[model samples]
Target: MRMNFGHLRGVHVRVFVPSSPYFPAYAQGQGPPPMVQERFQSVISQLFQYRIIRCGGAVDDDMANIIVAQLLYLDAVDPNKDIVMYVNSPGGSVTAGMAIFDTMRHIRPDVSTVCVGLAASMGAFLLSAGTKGKRYSLPNSRIMIHQPLGGAQGGQTDIDIQANEMLHHKANLNGYLSYHTGQSLEKINQDTDRDFFMSAKEAKEYGLIDGVIMNPLKALQPLAAAAEGKDQGSV
Candidate 1:
């Protein structure tokens, strides 16, 4: 599905993963031990079983692709299921985050985003873009939003172009914040002008998350039920 970033220039992003039709050496007994491979497979299986995707490192094209694929795969397998995304990153590549942020809103299955560590900049954007009431953060998680950064080389013309791009990008980001957090443009602009940081509770107060997660099982119950309800309806 196409994404809408409103007034921001559209940039095509691609996610690349090296793959082959034939089995790898690992599967052919030339790599890790079978036991190790089994453990690796088991861990991967658990991710799909729980329908959870982790975005722990800096956000980039690869992470964005993986997330979109996971979300799409989950929806295809069971459209009514919930996809839990745990984010812990300093955030990177605004374009990359925008891809995931837009996909989170476009997907059919409900998405619950949990901040396990730090969700700064683009990470903060993704956290707030979660399925509204399903947005969450751990007790100790930190959330932040700030203006975009840029540096230009070449000549003055190149520098001017980069500066203009940052301005438009900031405006688009502000609009995104207003749409998701129910905050006005003025307030979002004021807060994001600096390196704004907040604790989980403070984030909730700022309308970034619905609540701070205290008990995982209890906190996820409603989301689970909602997914099941969708499943039953589809069936």
Candidate 2:
């Protein structure tokens, strides 16, 4: 079935729930029951309405593709609205992470990144790259930054090429971190040489995030108040 949310008009979300192969009912061709499809569609519609994107697990090409699409689509739907991204990732694939980062900046809507748990390596980079003054982390979340990790198992020439590419990526990433965190290039390079971890408060002091979210309700009060004010004005 096609699901369309009011905020996400013109965006047709198709819910496809494949029948479980192991289920005996499926073997008889009684497939993905209507209830399952409705549930999936409902969740998708809600996510569209809320404009919430989640980045969990490793940052790979597939994950990056989805995020980029979501960011672009949401911006097209409503650029005035802010997009909230919840990041809890171990980090992987520098290219993939860069894709998401660039798209986050390229879009018209402001992207607010929240570190719900651990944001390590490229994950930390993306967390820091969010719109300035909007990056946040939960009180107990952990953030880590380090150089890109890679290995080569080929001929000497191939290994040399791979090494040079890794160095290039490391330099670019260091520059990005310096720009985002207002830290010196030398300091960023030094801290990222190894696995440098920080608590949420430490990350805020280090300039990786604007604030540590100690109380979620308090943090959201401004938005709530703004909405209430708008409602009152409309009335």
lDDT of 1 by residue, 1-235 (tens): 1111221224756533223111123333357677876786677667667887777666777778878887888888988877888788777788888888888778899898778888888888888888877787878888988878766577898778877878888899999899888989999999888788899988888888877766556444444533333321111
TM-score for all predictions? 0.77, 0.77
For model 1, which pairs clash?
A: none
C-alpha RMSD by candidate, in order: 8.8, 11.0
Model 1 has how many clashing residue pairs?
0
**In model 2, which regions exceed 4 Å deviation?**
1-41, 218-235
Worst 10 residues of 1 by lDDT: 1-10
On a 0 to 1 TM-score scale, where does candidate 1 land against the true structure?
Answer: 0.77
Angstrom error of the Cα, residue 45, model 2: value is 4.0
Across 6-50, the per-residue lDDT of candidate 2 in tens digits comes to 111246765432222111133344557778857766765676578
Best by lDDT: 2
